[model samples]
Target: MTNRPLPRSFTHVDTWVFDLDNTLYPHHVNLWQQVDARIRDYVSAYLKVSPEEAFRIQKDYYRRYGTTMRGMMTEHGVKADDFLTYVHAIDHSPLEPNPAMGAAIAELPGRKLILTNGSRDHAREVLARLGIATQFEAVFDIIAAELEPKPALKTYRRFLDLHGVDPARAAMFEDLARNLTVPHDLGMTTVLVVPDGTKSVVREDWELEGRDAAHVDHVTDDLTGFLQRLLPKR
Candidate 1:
């Protein structure tokens, strides 16, 4: 992560939009393993290609297309519903209920929302696994947003407008550094969750040069700890 000065203080905002998936659950759990396997299988089955070729094709398609689902839609004419169902059919046993997280979220001083690049079913499964599904007012996932994923200003703008959120009064909490960039630019306070078990560093090239560093208002290894600091003690 970039070594930058922290914001002096963060006001308790009216709306708090959270990113699902790795943000709700730690990344070290390797939840993506199942998702990746599903993607590979989907490519092989639908494209009628070899496993090796499917793997390569999946990566290539993901690179060219924003998401593997998008690639499937364009190439194999697979319906989005079928794609989401097939990919998210993974065992969610690794994720356990986090009561500490529930308490922290419950103590927060505003409405909370979930914004994710996954399907709503996937987001619901994750939140349900974490035992914090009830804390959010609504979940806006890739399907709800018409397949336009995050890191795009248009998505963020549309999300804000859809929810009647004022960017200046809202804050975004995410685990990915890249995902926080556009939110920061749109005047939302951004917080990056650098979980302690993260294997790789989470800095982007732009952040290293201090170009996108200003957008990130805070970084912490613990989401609950950050919330504890920002909210009153229970």
Candidate 2:
């Protein structure tokens, strides 16, 4: 959290857009670690490469393309469904329900939606584990974006068009600061959800970069606290 005053700019927001995964749940939970490992395994087996080679290729694809799956789809002709299904088949038990966060999200004004690069099934499972499945009106997922991932302008445009969300009246929350860039440029209030720096989490160096960028309007390590502060006191 910054020393600056709370974001009063959010008052005009009529649609609250949240990214799934690390944004909704604390990163310390390590749920994404399982998914990351599964993705590595998939890559190793799919390409018949060694573990080290797989790791290198996986990250290289991720860097070149917004997502590893997207890169595979483009270069190797991998089917999106096959890749998504394999990577997301991980344990969800690590994610316990957050009642306070759920309450805060349910209390937020107007429509609440999930915008995720992961599949809708993955988003639904995560939301179910968080006990906030019913809070969001809809999920705009990678499948909905025709296998394209976030940070892509066209994907964001598809979401806006499909949901009828007016960017000026919407607020977007994401764990990765870069993902908020397009939303901010489109006139939405951008909030960066960062790790609290208390625990180690598996992530790339670039994924942790760009927190102080101009596109980020607000940054918070505590999603629940941040959302709670956005609403008027009871």
Candidate 3:
């Protein structure tokens, strides 16, 4: 948690784009697991499959089609909005307000925005829990991206167009390093937020080396500390 100067390349950044979920709140909260189980249930009940089978297909579809929701839409004709609402219906009580994080975020010098594959409602809930809803200029969610999830080039292009953001002058922060590829290719400095103690999430072989990818600009286990370091001196 050292507070230090950021790389010189970051000095040109004027917009800060962050991913929600594990990027905003620490993964230790296990809130995502609740949504994950709900998705499994939805898939199981819809397809009449066992929960085990549903979970398998859920992950498979998630990997194949960017999101299980997208795969369900493509394969099962599931309604995107409905699926989002169902999956995100879990209790967000595990999350507590993070005023320190909110304060550190306020110290950042740029227009802030959240880019997520989640629904706006869920994003609102989480941000409210973190007590930082007003800090963001906007949230670009799945519906906002026309249901196109992240890691998808078109979604990134659409978001950039809609926000009038200059890729070269913006920075993208995400928990998944792979999600940073498009942003990095689009000329944004990418930071991977892998907060301490959540390393076990890299279950897949590819995920194992994501932080080593060329598109990954930096890795930090402490996001607030990272932001604090990047803040300009008063």
Candidate 4:
């Protein structure tokens, strides 16, 4: 992957907020498979639906609610906390500590935070598996943030306010392009992590023309390399 210059807006930031899940780890590992299975089981058991029906309904609910837990809570009357606990109970052994990523994160110049649409327990598990759980100053997960997920401008704003962060000075690194839009609007420098040889599917709502395209400061195949370029030597 090619290295790019850091955006001018990046110089104004003292904190970096990172998205968890697909952002912290590589996507091809299929780490979400276990979680997906748990979600399906929960749906089948609680909703009393057939496994086939549960799978179909779970997919639809995720599409509608932005998360399976959220859909379960709203439509199936499942308790949010219970659903979160159940769905995230999968083993995280697939995630081996990524020394390269851990080193890069260790060398970052400013405070770091994990912003995720999952429960704090899930985030902790992932981070611990990656061997970088102690690096971040704080974690703002769905429950901590009152269940408002990412790509929501309000959630981003609340995160900044809660952390006393200035958007103009902060940078957000995320795997999803759509999640970058809200931070970009809030004056934060946005970096899109496009894993090696991966092509990002343009969402129906994504307007990728002209100035809108410029809102994304950089795109990199690997976040470790991206951080090496953007952050000064520690």
Q: Against the true structure, whose TM-score is highest?
A: 2
Who is ahead in TM-score, 1 or 2?
A: 2
Per-residue alpha-carbon lDDT of model 2 for 1-234, expressed as tens digits? 767534438889999999998999998897888888888899999999998898899889888888889988898899999998899999999899999999999899999999998999999999999999999999999999988899999999999999999999999999988899999889999999988889998888888887878888888999999999988888
Candidate ranking (lDDT, best to worst): 2, 3, 1, 4
Give the top-scoring candidate (lDDT): 2
Per-residue lDDT tens digits for candidate 3, residues 1-234, read: 744435326889999999998889886676888999999999999999999999999999988888899999999999987898899998999899988788888888789999999999999999998899989999999999999899899999999999999999999999888899999989999998874874445234444357767788888888888888888788
Clash totals for all candidate models: 0, 0, 0, 2
Instruction: Summarize candidate 4's per-residue lDDT along 186-211 as a digit string, tens digits.
Output: 88889877546464432222222222
Looking at model 3, report the run of 10 residues with the lowest lDDT sum.
199-208
What is the C-alpha local distance difference test score of each model?
A: 0.79, 0.91, 0.87, 0.78
lDDT of model 3 at position 162: 93
- Ten contiguous residues with the weakest lDDT in model 4: 202-211
Model 1: residues >4 Å from true position, as ranges?
A: 1-9, 198-212
Q: Give the better candidate number (3 or 4) by TM-score.
A: 3
Candidate 1 on 174-199: residue-level lDDT in tens? 87677888887777888887656547
Better of 1 and 3 by TM-score: 3
TM-scores of the candidates in the order shown: 0.85, 0.95, 0.93, 0.84
Error of 1 at 57 (Å): 3.3
